[model samples]
Target: MVAGAPYPHELLPQLVEIFSEMSVCIGYNTSLDLGFLDRIGVPTEHLTVIDVMQRFVDYLNANGGTHRRASLSTCTKYFDYKWEGTAHNSLADAKATLYCYNMMKVIK
Candidate 1:
């Protein structure tokens, strides 16, 4: 393990394999999620990625102002997401992202 590495390189190939099998990967913030995956040795280039945060940035900036970063909680609440778990928890955030995505789909 390199200094401060979160996980060892073991399972990296499996992670890449999983991503290779994905048709689309949706993330609330691709810059963070995908970048973290890349930093952790996951090959992200092959996966078609969607950044929901960017998609909703216009709405987030609806007041004719520049886009400011919005937290997952804020986005979820805006979509009326009924959060089932604690905020800042990974699984909960993922669910919230999915809910927000579905809401966006409905709006479109």
Candidate 2:
């Protein structure tokens, strides 16, 4: 997350408060994430959501000609991202997802 984006690893704390003030966000499965926020009564109409997981899927299907959903571990490992912590864990997954987004941008 940047200066204005919510840091979700805070256990998704203060969701309504945080998202209500944010204009953009980077997330893994943003539909589910945003859905949760919507269910919790957080209005997300104004958010520019960047779903790393979904973007990875679009990238793969566009370049590799495959239709499938890739996991964070798969995307991270494909880019040979060195983990700063345990995989599958929340914070680690967040970092890995962002890393995937970074690599995908530069590599083709």
Candidate 3:
């Protein structure tokens, strides 16, 4: 499903609720992926939002490395990952974001 914007309130909560009912929702690379869910009134306690940025930072620090930028898109570009498509749909955008996030580790 595609959200109208990054901050599409209606879809976010619906997605969160669906995930909560199904299983723990997991996201990669994007720190703010679930922020919309919270901003649109999804309970933080009801869902889990993992910041892949923080996780990557921890991994980098553990291996004596550092990230130059904070944003996933920037980090992806800095690491030479390519996203060749527009982020029009939620799932596609999520996959692209994960690809970039995974590329960081792959580059390392």
Provide the lDDT at 88 for model 2.
64
Task: Give candidate 1 misplaced runs (Cα > 4 Å).
Answer: 1-8, 62-65
Give the candidates in order of TM-score, highest first.
1, 2, 3
Candidate 1 lDDT over 14-42, as tens digits, reads: 88888878878898888887887899888
lDDT of each: 0.80, 0.79, 0.58
Best by TM-score: 1
Question: Candidate 3 on 25-77: residue-level lDDT in tens?
Answer: 55654336556555666655655555556666666667777754355565455
Ranking by lDDT: 1, 2, 3
Q: Where is the poorest 10-residue window by lDDT in model 3?
A: 22-31
Whichever of 2 and 3 has more lDDT, that candidate is 2
Candidate 3 Cα errors over 4 Å, as ranges: 1-13, 28-35, 65-69, 87-92, 101-108
TM-score (all chains, Cα) for each model: 0.82, 0.77, 0.53
Model 2 clashing residue pairs (backbone): none
Q: For residues 39-81, could you state the per-residue lDDT of candidate 2 as single tens digits?
A: 6577788999888888888988888658567778878877899
> For model 1, what is the alpha-carbon lDDT of residue 17?
83
Model 1 TM: 0.82
